[model samples]
Target: MSVFDTACGQVRGSGPDRGVVAVLGIPYAEPPFGADRFRAPRPRSPWAGIRDCADFGPVPPQSAQLPGAPSWSPGDEDVLSLNVWTPAAADGAAPGGPLPVLVWIHGGAYTFGSGAQPDFDGAALARAGLVVVTLNYRLGFEGFGHVPADGADPCPPNRGLLDQIAALTWVRRNIAAFGGAPGNVTVAGQSSGAASVACLMAMDSARGLFRRAIAHSAVGPCYSPELAGHLMEKVAAEAAVPATSAGLAAASPQTLVKASDAVVDAYRQNPHSGRHHWDPVLYGPVADGVHLRADPLAVLAGGAASGIDLLVCHTTQEYWLLDAVGSSAKVTTEEHLNRFAADFGLPDSLTQGYRGLMPEAPVGDVHLALYGDLMFGEYSSRLADAHARAGGRTFLSRFARQRGGSEPVAYAWHCADVPFAFGNLGEESIRFLIGGAPTAADHHLSARMTAAWVGFAATGEPGWEPLGASGGPVRTWDAADTTRAPAPGHWSDSGTVRTLWRSFGYRPLRP
Candidate 1:
């Protein structure tokens, strides 16, 4: 056991397994419940004595039950805590100066996830000579559901985002005590968490908190206040309450969670429910024009994220995970494919272009390809390009590592790259995502991926040339060929998919 002082007080942590001390479950803010419910995070009241924090804290109000991670039952209030993994105080390590810090935000849409998720364990990164921090924020309706303002202290919108910001503020103030450089910090996440990183780049309060960012599979981020309001109404309807702050707040977290899930089921069952039918995820950071100035794409293109060094990554087949897990809508016939295209306002020419690209592919495959790009791939690429064009230091990479060319195949789909990047390929729970046990080649790829992350967090360089709107190297991580990164030459806009989305405008997902 080891002890370290934080702004709150001293904490005892377990570690030095191989030179890393992890201080888990330290409160970064007061729990957002009771008087603080549906509100911005309150600063944590300092503690007086040594707090034993050997295990992870309680998660937020979420319904997700990730394998090998704790699940949320009702009344788990202290969800705004964070964990630190560092070698600064580990056994058998010489004393060193402050190390670069990498703060992680977990991705489970905007509804349910915690820093305790298995893939986010920070020990590997800590071993690579960087202090790693992961945190939990409010999820589901409690964190993101819309509410009416009360007098001068209008309950803030994007309260989940606010919780994340509060955590980062805590890191800025207290990370140095964990042997981290307060001035040097990088924020990283995947899926919705990646979107949060993008939002943080464009946010005023989040400025100066992170000097660099790493976003993998950054899904769309932008929910208009009207859309947010409507979802709240639906949730209220499910809970049998009035669609007001008081009514929703009066309900229990368990009730709200069940209500929100019912609303999601309603959307999932009704094909005409618009975009939410395809993706029933109900909460997101509201672009209320105050906290988040605009949609992430527009904000980044307008240059708000220019000063931050950015690293973007996305898998080649992002939507397959959703399809495999029976989470996404499947389009099989030509009529449904056409309707799917029209649903998102995709151009006929673009659909035809994709057909030309993959003529033999079934309607479902075509739909997945187009839908994945619309939701993740194309959007993520544009973010990188926009940041680069606006004068930000940016790098882009694509994960294409797969299993056997023959038997027992696993596509380089969403989340498959995470465990590899984190170097936890041997874990049993994660093996299902990465397609069974890893091989020597997979281990090599994991090392390279981990090294790239270590290098970028340490120095803002990920072993590839800085990307630009016109041209730059794209580091390709592949197990098939571990000898070289990015293999041969690849273009900045090489694929037909890029040209198809050249002038497309992104809109908020609707119900």
Candidate 2:
């Protein structure tokens, strides 16, 4: 183990590289439980002696819905911690010469997921000459639920986001000892994590925390205050507790989690009823006009994210990973696609536009393609456009690599590109997602993806021209032949989908 001094205390980390070290489970904030429940995070108190930073810290209590999802459980409320990977020793100074930093935020629809998961190991990325850090934040009702707490201590909304800010603050003060330049940090994530990155950009509190940002398949970030209040009421009712911070603090985390799950389950069963204008997974950061005053996309369009270099990616078939929603087989006819579109107040003409784009694709495949756009593609494109229009440099790409045993799912479903980018495709948590065994081509593609990400983090140029507000340009990764060396191709956003996305209201989800 290698020992280093941080703001909080002395920490000893272990790593394989003689020159690389990893410090796991260092708290950035006091545990958000007991007296601290439902409150914004507070900085961790300093420790006296060398702290054993060997095993990962406890992750927040989470509810798992997928069969093979990574376990960040057996955990507790003392989970507002972070892990760091850096070179073992410095080149000149005690901490070492400054290195680029990559801070990853894990995604689980704002309710689940932890930074401690095996899928988020940063050793490989650390080996790529960067200080890699992953951190845990509050999730589900404890992190976000905004109840009316009349005559009680205030329960602030977006406690999870405040937790993230606290972690970043910890990094800024101490990462130099881990060989990272605070001014050169890049915040990145996938799915809801990506949405967090976007929301952070809009938050004035998050200003100057990081220099660059990368978001992968980011969904909507904020819920209407009415919706957030509604969900909190359901949770409060289910848990038989008053809708206030003092009442929730009296309840156990497991009880809150179960109550939250029941609320979402009911919404999923009948999503179209009443004010369920969005999907059940709509619980996230709320537009309380405080932490987040408005829609994040509108904020970005208004130049809230300006001056930060941005890179955003969306997989070709992101929605196909939704096994619960049935596969391409469910949508057999064009009429089916039209009916689905109508549910979201979209026009039947959108399906025709998609059909014209990929005429040879099967009808069900076309449906998957359309759903992909609705779920991830359209939002990502709008984010890119808004950032560019605000004069911020932006880069856009699509991951379309094929796999060996992916017959069950379509091309590059959600998160299929994560392991590749992190150069951890062999991780067991995502083995089922990776399909068959990793291939030589997979490794090669991974190398390129990592190189691009690292390059972006270091120099703010990802080996591509910055995409502007119009004339959309994209870099695509596809391996048509597994035996041959794969190369990324460039193309204009010539597809009609670009126009379609522009025409749509940029809503979170649709029919």
Candidate 3:
């Protein structure tokens, strides 16, 4: 049933059980198609009648090769839509009372992903006494490509970021009617989603839309204007068209998709030739003057977002899942070891250091640990340290519980903590990760973690002290026990590892 009608003439929603929810998929801006295809987002037209809020609206155009599932096109161009979940009836939630609102942005490396993934069901989070919202924005070339204009003030790149800002603005204006506290909002996301949260923190347009943020795997890399232009040119050449909005927009969607796929295929075959050696899909945020002032790490190091509370973390065995997928050939010899070291940009000394640490471990296991630390651990630790240095309230954690059925050595891989965080331990994806069925211990940890997350959204504190506070504490969640203290040896020594990483030019990438 409809809960409330938004100013844009879209009906906000409620869940099936009659519990309070307002799934508003209002268009914050006009469709990015036709003449507006690659231009900056413009304000939506004011509407005259209530719009239906029955099903998820069209996802932004993206590649079908997104991780974790098969992708297919769901044809429609109204891609700018948002879904909201709340706890009170539309008309009569105390007028000024505040309830925390959590806004989730999905991750797909800036090219693919949607708010409609089964794993990101906001129902559980909403049921736990908070309002949850998720939304879709443009992707691929449509969201990021730049076109020259003859205006006095040129539009900076990063139209995807602009879409996110627009969505947040919509929340600021309309969420309160669905029992959400416009003043107590929290922005949370994973992977590129986390990167988007970091960008939002740095963007002036996003200020005051949310009071706190939870950035899981927060990335710190952005594309330079030259680099983005080069990639766009390559895509245009592959499509046999001029590198302009008019030229590319005239091509059919299938033709554009094929051209993009061909470019990625070529890169995959000879990675060193392209700008994105490792991933063709890595089109991150750009440092356009208006949307992003500088790289997020630099901004964080300079105490940006100092006033906001943050919960930032990483999985312990972050790279094992990728290894399991990419290299079925187990690392068995020193030759294999050396190859992996070069691939992941591990320093010779650091590789030696890990070799010493795991003298008896398999070469593959060592490689997994090394890459995991490089990709997630060091960055997460640095983020915590940066937040602490900036005078922001930051709570850091490491998920160490190994999935049940997999090899005991697998540890907590990427996205492993999501099920526990959302209290969906029994879902198919969660069960696949945890093996068979979730035990009582799983339920307990889920409740505790979700409570901590909800608590963070509610207040600046997340049931733990900041990493570098006077108490010098951080949380560690495991199956055996969950506790907080001066971040155990693992988190504290990340700076040393990070230093070693820098020597090899293995910079931490953020968006």
Best by lDDT: 1
Candidate 2's TM-score: 0.90
Using TM-score as the measure, name the better of candidate 2 and candidate 3. 2
Q: Least accurate stretch of 10 residues (summed lDDT) in model 3?
A: 486-495
- Per-residue CA lDDT of candidate 2, range 131-165, in tens? 89999899887788775667776778888999999
lDDT of 3 by residue, 1-511 (tens): 6547566765745455546555646577888776666667877777876666756766776656543433536456777878877765434374457578899988776777888766677777877778888888877776776554434235447888888888888888888777788888899988778878878888878888888999886654666677677777788889898876566667655566677778877876673442243445646788765578876766776887888888987777777766665522346678866765666556689888777666777887887777677656766666667777888888888777775453563458777777788777767745556555787887888888899889999887667767664336657677765555533244223334445555643232322
TM-score, per-candidate, Cα-based? 0.96, 0.90, 0.88
Tell me the lDDT of model 2 at 188.
98
Clashes of 1: 0
Output the worst ten-in-a-row residue range by lDDT, candidate 2. 483-492
Collision pairs in model 3: 13-21, 13-22, 13-23, 219-510, 220-509, 220-510, 221-509, 221-510, 221-511
Cα misplacement distance, residue 175 of candidate 3 (Å): 0.6
Instruction: Give stretches of model 1 more than 4 Å off.
Output: 88-96, 150-152, 406-408, 480-494, 509-511
